[model samples]
Target: MAGLPSAITVYEVGPRDGLQNEAEPVPTAVKAELVRRLLAAGLPVVEATSFVHPRWVPQLADAGELLDTLAGDLGDAARDLPVLVPNERGLDRALERGCRHVAVFGSATETFAQRNLNRSWDQQFAMFAPVVERALAAGADVRAYVSMCFGDPWEGDVDPDRVVETGQRLLAMGATQLSLGDTIGVGTAGQVGDLVRRFVAAGTPVDRLALHFHDTYGQALANVLAGLLAGVTTYDASAGGLGGCPYAESATGNLATEDLLWFCRGLGIDTGVDLDAVVAASAWLADARGRPSPSAVVRALTG
Candidate 1:
């Protein structure tokens, strides 16, 4: 009920993480335009690209050009343009193109890590060791992702200790923030609060921790409130609620940005974002993808 930010910083990941796992690739122009639309809503952080290899995630290979060519107001409003970097090579390409921030992910479940990264969790951390050092030395802000913190479909329930351990390791390796991802969307409010509680008890800074959830069963917003009460403010959300994990078949779209914004308004927490603009943007992206958005708020607004 306390320790919440007066104004929460919502990181719009629709351009990058939300669209990456789609069965089809979107044009670079469409992606670039989405970035612009997000800024019209005045979101401070927009993760616009993923620097992964083309062979692995061909959807995001245009990352370099997107960063170079994206024009309009987004150029000025986006506080952190974080890109996903799987390794040092990925980091190199991102920095070369004026990327100010980058993110590296490690799963708490070993099996999921092996499937997603083809490496153990520890090795994934090791792969990022030099990447973190290089990024920090280059004056880039680094964010570390601890995925499947609540539970993994493949590995079942994850230990809270392991999640905290990975969070601590990434922070120790110079990551400025940690995003705990519920990759399968199976986390409930109690579980979310417990994980946040344990992470804080483990000496993790509450402000530096973020909650990334999916709404497979429509629990994302409820879980967000639970996190807010637990003193976690930062969140990762996708416009129009478009996303899913290719590695995990049952996964669904991420927590919808509009849905979260609606909740923030009801809670009297300022998000400093324009809801109508976000709905317009989400509608545009949904049309571009040729699918119905997972967001109830966007659906109703655009209906």
Candidate 2:
């Protein structure tokens, strides 16, 4: 009844997630270069850009052009790009740009979902419903993400049952895969395990579930391991562990892809990624940002 895999997939969100919260505006060339370097690092699925309002995320205003332009340039490497598109306009833009896979996000908390989408949970799905239908009809893969799945900045702890309900709603709306995010990175291993177990118990099927964690307290890797044990084979990561929620006051970086690769390789899990290239890319970004990488492996290697 499910299409789960024995191995995991590492979706690199660096181009979109890593650069979104930069204190200074990152040039479009730099963003494109980041995607190029990620492709070189052997990532099969990369979240390239977000097609939301420029006023909300000025960092990704070039989402459409990036898609339009990068399509040809990626060449053989072009097949792995996944863009974050929030609305019908974005889907149209992506379709015009020929994006094969698109990602849309909703949040698990009522308050945060409303704050982000300006729509309640039901309204959010109602909105994404058409986009999902169109993407599927166009033969594009759709990944549905739910932010603040573990916890939210405004809303404290969220109910597991509510999270399952939201996930089910997204799936019922035809979202092929679902990603659960730790928006503020406040989840522990026990909490992460419990949440993943709850979703699995609710018949959400582990294969369709993905984890997006922030290493705010250095626990994201631990959480990833827990998810893998729960039969969740997909996790989202950002290069150099960069990026945080602009709305979340004290949030840190998303879990670094380089570090996660290191962990997976240690456990004999095939990441299909190159650690050296990822480290080099991380180093370059860290130097550009003037911030030490949150990844332990990067810090150790650079030091």
Candidate 3:
């Protein structure tokens, strides 16, 4: 606790990132309710959905409809909703729906870039440039997610320098913030510390960076602690630990929002989130999905 920030921001990704990979289609109304519950639970930033084509991620096909519902229902709370836009077309859809905050995803490795975006690293940046430019010009906040920042399933042990370079490019492309992702869940605490330090040294502002980790290797919280020590304040988490990269075979569920809240609570760090409420939401989501909640905290507390 000596060097960590007194408070941190948790960006909830359960409705979008969490449910996008589910094999079964979650009803559009269910997704709307999930976002509502997460907001009611005091999550400051909730990623609502993605504008990716339904042909690819059919689960989130109702992205525009969901946004419309939230706009009419959530009112001011809807201002915090951020959706993922994969390219110019996705950005166009989001803008047409009056989205104020959006995120574009890229990769640090060539394999994931080609697999997920159908482009190489340079090409991916080229693809994102216009999206970022158009979003910023439209007065929307743009967040960039750089995947495989720590390790890639195909290319193990990604270089920190490369990660920094990718993050810088994103920031330069009008991205208001960068979320560095450990896509394969192979990152360690030490690796996190080194990477954050390198980013800070290379002139990247700590406040503009976020960490997105998967709990596959059971190292999510440890790496989070490391990020905290390195002065990172924003983190991305999914309720009930519900998401994994569909393109990466070995990747697993994201760091559970309830689990992260529990850890932050124990550290006396303020996340402005209710742990019990998040657990209840996760439990509800699990029941709806016809599966057990993957969050350790949710399971233990509910049981």
Top lDDT hit? 3
Per-residue lDDT tens digits for candidate 2, residues 1-303, read 133344568899988988888777787777777788888888888888888888988888888767655666776345458888889988887787677888898878878868878888778888899999999999898999988877777779888788889888889878889999988888888888898888878888878888999988888988987777777888999888888977676678999988888888878788789989999998987787787887888997788
Off by over 4 Å in 3: none
All models: lDDT?
0.87, 0.83, 0.91
The per-prediction CA RMSD against the true structure, in angstroms, equals: 1.7, 3.0, 0.9
Provide the lDDT at 300 for model 2.
79
Q: Arrange candidates, best TM-score first.
A: 3, 1, 2
Candidate that beats the other on TM-score, 2 or 3, i.e. the better one: 3
Worst 10 residues of 1 by lDDT: 71-80
What TM-score quantifies how close candidate 2 is to the native fold? 0.93
lDDT of 3 by residue, 151-236 (tens): 88888889889899999999998899999999889999999999989989999999999999998899999999999999999999
* Candidate 2 residue-pair clash tally: 0
Candidate 2 residue pairs in backbone clash: none
Give the alpha carbon lDDT tens digit for every residue of 1-303 in model 1.
356557788988899989889888999999988998897789888898888989988888898778766734346333357899988899988777666789998889899889889999888888889999999998888999988988889888899899999899999999999999998899999999999999888888899999999998788988998899898889999998888887788788899999999989988899899999999998988888888887999999888
TM-score of 3: 0.98
